[model samples]
Each structure stands twice: as structure tokens, then as C-alpha cells.
Target: MLARLLATAAVGGVVGFIVFHPREAEATGPTATVDADEAQRWLLGGNAWFVKGGRHVGDTSVERRTAVAPSQAPSCTILTCADSRVPPEHLFHAGLGDMFTVRVAGNVAEPVTTGSIEYAVEHLGTQLVVVMGHERCGAVKAALSDASLGPNLDALLALIRPGIGEIEDLDEAVRANVHAQVAGLRRSAILHHAEAEGTLTLLAAYYDLDTGVVTFLDSPPTSAVAEAAASPRTPAEGHAPTH
Candidate 1:
């Protein structure tokens, strides 16, 4: 009798488990949609709250909902290095659609890169373009260290080499690379026209990985224009041009 009772109990438990574990088709629910503007507002508020040492006003559900929304057009375009350490969203405290970002090794502005920037400016209506670089950049380091590379890499290294050659210090070389890329972007016909017409503003910045701080090379706005203007034409040679 006891054996029969134990068998009956086991049967019941097995039946209960089977009933509770529904098939995949039966477990689905209605899809949830997100509102982009509300998400942006929440993200902006969250950043401000975090900066002020305040608690999260919203919960994970809200963030999850926000994640599903379509990203709106970005007002700013950033051309930055493809470094794992330098995540643009985290560094800028931005959420989806807040900034349009293009990442390349060494943040080199080749023709293709400039073309993308032009499309963003002309179509997406991004008013600001930032060319950013970071400390201990591996691309810049490779260009500095390696004298010989295969054709494709050598071409990339050539672009980075001019900037590396401009600065004696490795640390300064990183910043010089950022400034050089910014100059290269500015000189592009599309960007130059945009700048002259005051439709776009181009700036360069350096990211400090250790400190989590971004220093604008051309702070005060005016200084960037002046510095770019004063920068020697033959920057790689390290000689300031005489009047």
C-alpha cells in the first residue's frame, strides 16, 4: 500500500510540473512598443540625477521599454577611435539617438570618412562634428613603432604617421592625431563649405582613460579656430611658420 501511495504522489508531481511548463507558443504575450521622446527625457534626467549623486527615479522596466524605441536623428556627429575602452555613450553620458558616432582606428579622416560626415551634416542636420582621440592609442603606437607594414595597413599607418611625427611625446602624439584628423576634416570641401557658412562646427577633443575626463583641445571655442589657423602648414617637421 505504501509503495502504491509513493507511486501515486510521484505521478501527481510529474503531472503538476508538466502542466506548469507550457509550450513556447502558449507562453507568448502582446508586444510592447516604446516612445522615443519619453525615453530621451528619462535618459537625460537619469544622467543629471546620477551626476548630482541622486538615486534612479525609474526602474529596469522603464529602461527596457526605452531600449525598444527607434532612435531619432542625432544633433551631433562624433568621429572617434575604435578603442574598446572609449565607449562614446558612457563617456558622454548619452542614450540612443543622442549622438551619431563613427568609429575608425586612430580616428583617421579619409575620403570615405569625410563623405559620411558630409552626409550626416547635409541630410541628418547634425550641427556639431567632433574628432576625438584617446590616450595610449594602439593605432598611433603601431604607426610610431612599425616602419614596415603590408600595403593596406601601411596606407593607414601613413595617415597616422604625420600626426605621430608632429609630437615628440607619445602622450602628445595622441592629441596631435586628434587635432590633425580635425584639420583634415575641416579641409574637406563639404566640411569647409559648412564651416564657412556656419552650418557646422568642427572641434577636437582628447579622452583620458584613467581620469574619465575629456579635455577639449580648443576650449573657449575661439581658441580652436585660432589654433587651427596658427598650426604650421608643415606640422610634421615641428617648425612654426614665420610671418
Candidate 2:
């Protein structure tokens, strides 16, 4: 699965849904210890509530806020695009500090991004990592375009450009970018160690803006993922066809 995943850069138009479990409680202080499987349940169930139009946003009352004010013990770390439309908490109906999020234009796991997630995993006792990409993502659209964005935007696009190649389909592009970013996250030594030691659960997801459905991308076996992340890649790599 890692070889196949690494070999291709294009994401199919199909949406894959949720899976995986997390680390056991290892964090100290006010951080809450969350079971990865249980956390997945909350996210999946919360999404159900979201799709049903039920208000399931976890407690946000002053007391709830006060309790989590000292320190946050999020169950999962979500690395997703910074698109305003795809708020992880609202989409999953999660409440205060239920998740720790790292948002970027294309959800790229650059140095700082990886570091933030690592902090959650090592210090906060978060055992699960969910890397989500949404449909109609502006960052992806930008990456697919030939237009001249500013320096920073271009740099961001540079990171995304090689992931999906020249795929013209937006859905395909979004899917490809998500997996590529997942690979990038796995490259983090801290994250890789966590996965290798059986203390982490990594997953990919697709968010449909229209239907409000979050389809989790299929992940490879643990060993495969670890091996693939350990493998090196250059800027010229991963220009695969859309399936």
C-alpha cells in the first residue's frame, strides 16, 4: 500500500471515509488522554450529527471553557487546508479542545506544521492524527493553475505542485494533494516514531462541501506507511496519473 500510495500523485474523484486508532494515555498535566479508536467514534458520530443538522457541538459553556482553559487535551490532530469553509470542529461537531488543528493553504506538513502536531502527540497525549482535505479547496485550485500568485502563495503552490502533477480535475487534485500531504506528515521523525512504536493512528479524509460528508481516505498498513515515510523523495518525484 505504501509503494502504491507513494508511486502515484493523483487522487481519484471518489471519497474514502474514516478508520484507525490512537496511542494510550501518556501525557501529563491537564492534558486528557484519548483512545484513538474512541476518538474516531466521537468524530464519526459527531459528523453524523452534523449531517443530520443536529446541534452536537460539544459543551462550550463557560464552565466547559474554564475546565479546558489551563491546558488542552485534544484527542486528534487535524491537518487541513485553511479554507474558511472547512472548520474541523464544526464539521465534526467537536467541542472545546476536542481537536488540535494545524491549518495551512494546502495542508502541507512543513517544519512548523509537523512540529505543532508532534507537540500534540508527545506532550498532549494525542494519539490520533487526521489529515483532511476538502472538495473545492482554493489552495488545490491554486496549485493546479498556471496563474502567477504572489511569492508566498507560489512557494506554497510549489509544495503542492509536484504532488498531483498536472491533473485537471478538481476532485482528483484535492484527493491527490491530501495523500501527498499525508506522506509528508509521516516523514516527521516524531510522528514516524509514534507510528512505529504502536502509539499513533494516522488517517486521511475528504470533506464534501455540498453534502457535508467526511470520507476518510484508505490508509496503508503500519509497516508500509513507516517504510514509505522513511523513503526519500525529491521535488521531481510523485507525478502520477489520476485513477
Which candidate tops TM-score?
2
Clash pairs detected, candidate 2: 16-215, 16-216, 17-215, 17-216, 22-36
Q: What's the true lDDT of residue 61 in model 1?
A: 40
**lDDT tens readout by residue for model 2, 1-243:** 532331122110111222222222222343246666656655665665566565544555575555555455567788988889988878776656567788988888788888878877876667889889999989889888899889989989988988899799999999999889888989988999999998898888899999887777875434433332223222122110011
- Clashes per candidate, residues 3 or more apart or on different chains: 0, 5
lDDT tens readout by residue for model 1, 1-243: 432232111110000000001001011211221222222222233233333333333222444234323222444677888899886655554433445678888899998788777766765455678888998998888787766778887898799888668566778888888888998998888889978987777878787777655556775534332333222112011110111
lDDT for model 1, on a 0 to 1 scale? 0.56
Which numbered prediction scores highest in lDDT against the true structure? 2
Model 2: weakest 10-residue lDDT segment is 234-243
Query: Model 1, 175: alpha-carbon shift in Å?
Result: 0.9
Model 1, runs deviating above 4 Å? 1-71, 221-243
Question: All models: lDDT?
Answer: 0.56, 0.68
